[model samples]
Target: MGAGHGHRLHYHGHSRLHRAPAHLKLVALVGFMLVVVATPRELYPVFGGYALLLVAVIASTGVPFGYIGKRMVVEVPFVLFAVLMPFVATGPRTEVLGLSLSEPGLLAAWGLLAKATIGVAASLTLAATTEPLDLLRGLQRLRVPDLIVQIMAFMVRYLDVVTAEMGRMLTGMRSRGCDPRSPRHWPLLARSVGALFIRSYERGERVHLAMLSRGYDGTFRL
Candidate 1:
């Protein structure tokens, strides 16, 4: 369904980045992000270099800028929260564009912005290049907590099923002449959402049970 949520889950044709081992990519990304997160806030040039590296990676992938921009919107909440550090963080106030800005806040914001962007970019790039299954294998090989890897594996596998189920529920409601926009229908719509949540919860429980019965453990050998 073309990554119905607007996230690019599929990769395009042959590229050197795509051919790289997933563990190597993951390690490189983690190391790069560590540098970004560890750099002093006063080092604006460091952040600039990080951004340039991200741009180069993106360019190498042949992914559209629009796709990156769209995915970055998901980071806005973190960005906004990070931006607030300047107002409330304890530090010397400095004049920037004639406005007093918190010195600590400015640094905090830079730190967060760089870390968040680099992490997201690296992650999205990885996801775009590798299949979901390969990504899971990479994580496992990297010795990511088995539980975390399992959860991620399950989530990636089931996300589409959940999305389809939700879509069907929405379709059923629409087919029944449900007017979600009507004030009178608000209660019904709310109930539908609640029911959907319940159904999803139950489905997860059942799936877990089934997995247990099938000799599933903390890790899948495959």
Candidate 2:
């Protein structure tokens, strides 16, 4: 991947975590997440310990807590699902704050929220410290298949490109008096989205042909 590819997520730090070998960091992250996942849900205090451990790691990185908090908006869907569980799930009900909610679901939601939050925080921390290219190299070192790594590399590289394309298309739509945000314009928005997909697909094909012409044989250097 290019130097610019994953720089947005990286905080450009000089801490030990920043200098740690990418493969080692990857292994440590997976191990930490596994331990968090395997812990019994009823052992709520253990999750507090896990959260503190992550907090220590985050503090060492010198990345702002608010920065991590802002990036955590991606986990809102998980939060919403967890919030609904107590009401929607089937179980014996209990009262809290003058509301009846499923007892089992309350526990399940707590467990789900804790795990999901920690997982997102850990992954974001990793991204904040490590470059995309280093992560790919780490994957290769771990014997992850070259083809899979290459696909990941390309996906990272193209995310910005695809996003820019979508932005331009949206701009064009607004220029033509089709407001994508308006309910009546949804059909136009959907068609534009379809067009964007076709354009992206064609761009991928052209990229593949270019790579092939340059002696790529189903794989190239990462």
Candidate 3:
């Protein structure tokens, strides 16, 4: 990846966490997430401990809480699924707020929410402290497969390019009087998505050919 390709998730910092070796941080992050996942759902206190640990990590990074909070919106779909679990799951029912909810489902939902939240927060914290290139380097150092590392490297490098292309496509559609909110515009919107995919695929192919010309031999060099 080029030095110019800085990810939005990376917060510029010189703190200890930021300076920590990328592979070590990667190992720590995976271990922390694993511990969170392995803890029994009934062990609520353990979950609290995990939360506190994450808070400490976040505090050390000096990244803004607002930045993390905004990114947490990515977990909203999981939150919604957790919320519906109690209502839809079949099991022993109990009354809460004048509605019957499955007892097992409620516990399951709580566990799911807690685990997912912590996992995402940990990931966000890692991203905030580590640059995209450094992350790829870390994975490479950790003996991750070269092909997978190359894929991730390209993803990090071209994500912005692809996103900008999509934005331009959308703008062009709007300029052509396309109103995506209107039912009549659904077909056009779908076609736009298809076109975007095709364009992205072609662009990837071109990039691959260019890489090959430059002696990129199926492996990314840090």
Question: What lDDT does candidate 2 reach at residue 26?
Answer: 99
Q: 12, model 1: CA deviation in Å?
A: 2.2
Q: State each model's C-alpha RMSD to the native.
A: 4.1, 2.5, 2.7
Worst 10 residues of 2 by lDDT: 1-10
Q: Which regions of candidate 3 fall more than 4 Å away from where they truly are?
A: 1-5, 179-190, 215-222
* Candidate 1 C-alpha lDDT tens digits along 1-222: 435542346556578887888888888877887777777777788778878988898899887767766777778899999978888887789988897889878887877887788788777777787777777788889999888998897788778877777778878888988747779888887888898789889999999899899998756776
Which residue ranges in model 1 land beyond 4 Å of their true spot? 1-7, 90-101, 171-194, 212-222
Clashes of each: 1, 0, 0
What's the ranking of the predictions by lDDT, best on top?
2, 3, 1
Please provide, for model 3 over 73-169, each residue's C-alpha lDDT reduced to its tens digit, 9 standing for 90 to 100: 9999999999999999998999999999999999999999999999999999999999989999999999998889878978887788888887788
lDDT of 3 at 60: 84
Clashing pairs in 3: none
Per-candidate TM-score against the hidden true structure: 0.78, 0.91, 0.90
Best TM-score among the predictions, by candidate number: 2
